[model samples]
Target: MTRRASATISTQPSVTDAPLRYRLIHDQLKNAIALGKIAPGLVLLEGPVARVFGTSRVPVRKAFEMLHAGGLLHTFEGRGYVVASPDGSAPPPLRAPLSESALGFDEAHAPLALPSNSERIYHAMEAAVSIGITFGHFRIDESEAAEAFGVSRGTVREALSRLRDLGLVEKSAYSHWLCGPLTARAVAHDYELRVLLEPAALRASMPHLSKEKLTLALAEVERAIDEPDSIDADALERIETALHVECLSQAPNKKLLGMIGHAHMPLTVNHAFYNAFNLHPEAGTLVEHRAVLKHLLAGSTEAAVTALADHLHAGQKRTLQRLKVLAVLPEPDLPVFMHRIS
Candidate 1:
């Protein structure tokens, strides 16, 4: 039988963090092992851990290297690393799931320190490339991207590697990085997967959704309804995180989360739709979000699940409509990193 990781995957940030994906994975594994969910002497495999993070094995391997360096794991000459048992008398602090940590914030207090510069650059590139791709297909130019972002060639490459993992970008026959014009088939496939996965996650999430968190998430919806003019990629992520990822954070299964993240193409596709059409998120979206929250607040898990499903259905409809609008748009004004291919 395959061993599943404990629900507490411990993706929390460490103090004095040097920003890198591998380092974050390393910390999470360390925390998990210390908490005893991952038993001592259990062989840690890279493939499973990489899937949990929705990333590639390259980072996971690097994380293992660091874990071994820190004496958290022991390596045999032939076999892979083993989780070194901690001192019996003292165990490390157990970390809570993300929903527990994120439940009580309002607009008054700012969110945690934003990701590092390279991290921020990664998201920026994704948004620009997504919007540009929606307008029309484009081949990416590594040098041009570096110059446009004012970052080094290495930084752009790192960002591009992440994009490739997300299935949002691809390499072409001519050895160029090609970004979308996301196809209708791709959109349909994503919806099918979400319909299967998200409701199950929402059902599993009810016990974890605190009133404080529900209220906070509800308030954000209301605010967005009142001020939906600036629904950029980051803003969209905030809304989705509050509704989707946060609610699902408590679910015992980490692989479900990974599958959802890997196939969650609509987030970018819908953002691109809005940008290409030059419109704000629909008012109906706010109402839909409210309905889901109201159901959750009233302690109706099934109803909440239904409302969430309806919201997804509505989003699918709007995405189709927006696709029609995007169909006629010209090649968008894009950063130099993108070269028109079609």
Candidate 2:
């Protein structure tokens, strides 16, 4: 008979109290391993762990790497990690069901409250609503959304409420949540705000911009442009985010940054357009992004600002064209959670 590892729960600090989210997840998993709660030879996959934690796979991936490094986990013949035996020997892989309870995550003892289900579903819903709005106004079915995401109704409500805060959705007078018919006027309004604000934010952020970050940003653009056919909506969005979001993240003013974030509805618009049409970004966009990144790399703050503003101006036109195409095209089938109101 194999000897079981002694179960020892850490008494130091709550996992949630960790500053970095990945670190928190790592610590929790490590503790679980130490306690033998994670059975030896159990296969731990990223997607399941992310869903269990109500987080994206990125953090779970990082946590898995940390565990593997610590010898608590080992790479097997297939994907994901297999728990190592207490004697550091390989055991038969166990593809058993993993749960919070099995991992010693419970309310009474460690109290490792997973992130709210709302957070887990927010991005998917955001993408749906953002893309749906371009074609026509929509009324979101809260119950259906909850069912679709396999979460509670209250969770969907919280996610929609956050969208409302971001100006992505609105509550009707009759207490219904509405998304949009994203009009050219609304698109222009968002671009106008971005044109005025983002350049200023860029200028403010210039001194704080690191060379390595700029180089990486430049590399991403180059790669996307070099491999246009392979580029997907997510990659395209990352390039846009590198310039508009990540690059401007170092600006000194919090209020200004907050306002800029709210004004970035256009980014979503572009993202929706590309995804809806199954298209890649135009060469022009890649070039414009490259120009601004180059200017920043060369330490030309003013040039970078000018290039960024110009790019936004040009992007507004391209975005308007995308809206026009959506206007002409047949309306796509709405998701179960969405119903056309107009």
Candidate 3:
């Protein structure tokens, strides 16, 4: 996700106008990572990188430092920095069921209500993380983050604090916040929670769900499948949420609706998983989603649940395959548990 600049450029010449040389370098390195040209766990050297970029050590140092603060690169005692491993080992292999313990937000603390300034910073961070724009490769400087959000540095800090509590962000050795990398384990855990909650909610609402509502929901899912490339992160999110929530909303049970609503962030994380794994043409995850929607609209809750479960399991397989090709992890040991679902 490209960060949309809210502030207009000033006519006056300033450091901001000069296009921070380090930012250019940062973007280049980021593009390389995304392209898999530089695999994760590869170390980066400041002196060598600076020489390659035809710049002095200062900007290169700043760029690596920034990446380190974002959790993309990790610092060693004397080896400079290495691309951080996604799971602190190898990334999880495909077809791996998420560990049961990995599901909920870090229970270390609760999210607090945000003030206006904090809210702005939070929104900016959320937008970046959701669309894989940042991917733990850049730090938001307190003053810069404040300026970006039109708030005070203190408010930005407050927002960062909240994100930290949620495990969405972590503090670096440099006292900067490094947004954590999205992991498959985390994604699968959220999907499990959704599977548990959403079907029940939809079932409760079946008696009250109007034909028009069901039709519209199925249409949205179909549209998403038809135009996967055209869909933005936000649109993808909406379509995924509607598939679950449209029917769930008709439930007479307010408590169930509230629970589903509370799972919104987790749902977003789960959607991100699909975004990452669906990179392969063979996955056809959108088609699988459409299949689940078809079953749901046919008033076949059991079939929908079975289809949804298979869809998720297939995702695990595809993601693992991609990761192996990228050499992030070895071929997975296909588990017997997945067969039980079938």
Q: What are the lDDT figures for the candidates, one per model?
A: 0.70, 0.81, 0.55
TM-score order of candidates, best first?
2, 1, 3
| Cα-based TM-score, every candidate | 0.61, 0.68, 0.45
Taking every candidate in turn, the Cα RMSD to the unseen true structure, in Å, is 15.8, 14.2, 22.8
Q: Model 1 over residues 274-325: C-alpha lDDT tens digits? A: 4333455667877988999999999999999999888888878777776776
Please identify model 2 stretches exceeding 4 Å from their true place.
1-116
As for candidate 1, its clashing pairs are: none
On lDDT, the candidate that comes out on top is: 2
Collision count for each candidate, in order = 0, 0, 2
**Poorest 10 consecutive residues by lDDT, candidate 2:** 6-15
Clashing pairs in 3: 94-320, 95-316
Candidate 1 scores a C-alpha RMSD against the true structure in Å of 15.8
**Cα lDDT tens digits for candidate 3, 64-102:** 888777766776654666665655443322221222111
